[model samples]
Target: MVNSWWRRSARALAIALLLSFAAPALAADDAADEVGYQFSTDWTGPHTAVWLRHLARFMKKPDIHGLEIGCFEGRSSIWFMERIATHESSTMSCIDVFTDAIEARFDNNIEVAGFSDRMKKHKGYSQDVLRKLDYASFDFIYIDGCHLASCVLTDAVLAWDLLKPGGMIIFDDYVWALEKAKTQRPKVAIDAFMTVYANHIRVRERGYQVIIEKLAPRSDRELVGKPVVHSEEWEKDYEKKKKD
Candidate 1:
């Protein structure tokens, strides 16, 4: 068993060294350059590019593991694999509800990019697959499945379970405009999750996408899900703080 593990580890290291040379620099000349990838996808193109750059910092490190919810045309997934390729032990799992043309594009892009071995693709709604994932196993997770507040919150809560200490979670489309209801946006769900884990949450970026890091959780405590703050309580607390 020890020899087998060592051989596997050694093989992973060799693969990582080779991939490091193949991944591109996170920055793109233009947001539209996503077309340069096997599949083209953009949500706030310039911001997405910048967001990728921020992720680059964490991904460049060794032995990183990642999970992504929603692999539309494999755009962000491609970027992620590029960085993961740099580290031998790095691997990523992506969950997507594959149907119709998007399925082919996702498969083709990942295949053509030479990442078939480094990535594991899960075909299903993120909620179901997330339940089966090991706790605190991923170094990074990107949530982009459904834009609805309930769906986004569900993904965040579950992803929280899978994220490792000092791991990062990227919530895409935070400010995406869908109708006029603020509650309908990703920000609503992301903020609610933030309130639940306020002490452990570190905000990294807030714009078209929100990237935040999860600080190590204490062995003695647990977060019970959504924050306890209601509008009335929050206002009262804020007002009290101001008067004091």
Candidate 2:
């Protein structure tokens, strides 16, 4: 009986040591899986997927506050909600004009694309209202609504103001290709903002999005420069292989 008891205690000690060594790695793997799975649900397409993988690595640290400008059907919003819910200490807010703000531009195409119903369902700011009572305030903001330059610019400014210091502001569709020949693309607005506020900005995954740590006062010297473009060496190689 004494021998059996000694062996049981030894087994328990061994298990404890194993857990002490493995816990951190297990936690890291879970965090990585969370990022991959969450991003996959929000972003599709090859380029966006690639960008998201890198962005996930950057966001391993938990964000205290979060925001999303376009909460279409709440796919991305749901992702943020999960993050906030799990962390218990984080907050997220979302905004959307929801009903196709640029009806004249993508009306026919949007229907053909089968996004009409989805757009219609996004008509209200219900998610944001619900979240206000559900979670804490946001520390990160994501802008994905109103692709038009003017509207995007306005949202960007508002998001900047809303972001807390050390918070991140993310702009979706910042590098979108526009159909209008006369109107400038949304990138123009993003570039204009970055041109004046480059120091606070960091290009994530080759400029698919911009991450700003906080909003700061702009200066003439800062305004005079242009937006910094991230090198696309890997992307170029990938494209070349696809062509080949």
Candidate 3:
């Protein structure tokens, strides 16, 4: 009788121990299903979602590097982190001046997005935080900071210098925002870069975004001394078509 009781007690203990370990594994699986390994954010609209899905497909290989500029509150940064975590070998680098460097033009938008506290947590977007990251070294770059033409241009140039050969660079907000001044927006800078670098760069599936692979070493050409004639013609034609 005592042997029977002992056997039952041992079985109960073994079952409890197995369950304790299994619970966490089950919970982790559930969490993975909830978020998958993809990057997601409340700010991701239809275009952005489609673009990210396409990017994920393009990056199916094992040894891609990534970089992100203007990591405001880490929504996109966290997405990159998730991607890196899932891959056995991948790295990302981020850059930003962080503290209203261009102008506090979007203060209300940032606040409304509920990123004020999150932004404060990361040393206000200094490159120092990125310098010591333990993950894989960056092979691709994303630029989304300082929408002013000069600032955007500067950031792109700096990122270009850091970008590896065959790596890709992504820019945010390539479309015009009516509320912001037309002259110095992010799209303006991207357009300027694309016009000169069109030979080496290609537009990604995302209409506003572009992807460039560093094929051969290249130099930054001076911004065209004159306004782009092609853009004016295209814009004029677009407006005319719209009116009709």
Candidate 4:
């Protein structure tokens, strides 16, 4: 089991390394690359193409309703529109807190990609936009919002409420670092989310991007073999929240 963990880590690291070198080589005129220079953006990092491929495999069907928490320059949004939400009835919603030129670029990029009418753009912090959404209405959700531990955990819980049964939620930047080794960034929050919700969902893939499928209603036996982390401190926290 330890060897398996090491093997997955090694493979993830190798893919990360390869992404940096190969990102610039993706065909510019191809269908996937025609949506501006999103792939080249510094905010995208190296493993974007890999993430898109993963989304394709899991969300290949067209006409699905989707949500993206942080659209940034719309790289991942366009990827979803082009790859998975291709049917006329399909659409995606994006939420972001704008800064500088990113919002304008995000708009232009998705528009140029012919998704202007197909997407709903919400400008604000994720929490606000999420609150207005109908619960359990989304088929897929991609969360790349704030990196703070509490914020990420909040987004995860909210996304859980919005995700339909059998839907998938893809979390970006699971291992992001804010200040070398000082700040825990997204990992701490993601870890807490996984631990708290262990019985509610099934992990589909785990690496830089954590993907999980919300389980349909089932018997407790479904979670019989799943490992869980329990701590008295956490139990106290949970009880407090339950009372509130």
Which is the leading candidate under TM-score?
1
Model 4 TM-score on a 0 to 1 scale: 0.69
**lDDT-sorted candidate list, best first:** 1, 4, 3, 2
Residue pair clashes in candidate 4: none
RMSD of each: 13.4, 18.1, 14.1, 14.0
Could you tell me every candidate's TM-score relative to the true structure? 0.72, 0.49, 0.52, 0.69
Return whichever of 2 and 4 wins on lDDT. Answer: 4
- Where is the poorest 10-residue window by lDDT in model 1? 26-35
Candidate achieving the largest lDDT: 1
Could you arrange the candidates by TM-score from highest to lowest? Answer: 1, 4, 3, 2
Where does model 3 exceed 4 Å of error?
Answer: 1-41, 45-48, 57-63, 98-137, 217-244
Candidate 4 regions exceeding 4 Å error are: 1-62, 178-184, 217-244
Clashing pairs counted in every model: 0, 6, 6, 0
Of 1 and 3, the candidate ahead on TM-score is 1
Sequence-dependent TM-score of model 2: 0.49
- What residue pairs clash in candidate 2, if any at all? 65-138, 65-139, 65-140, 66-138, 66-139, 67-140
Worst 10 residues of 2 by lDDT: 33-42
Clashing pairs in 1: none
> Model 3 scores what on Cα lDDT?
0.53
When summed lDDT is taken over every stretch of 10 residues in candidate 4, the lowest stretch is: 23-32
Residue 145, candidate 2: C-alpha displacement in angstroms:
0.7
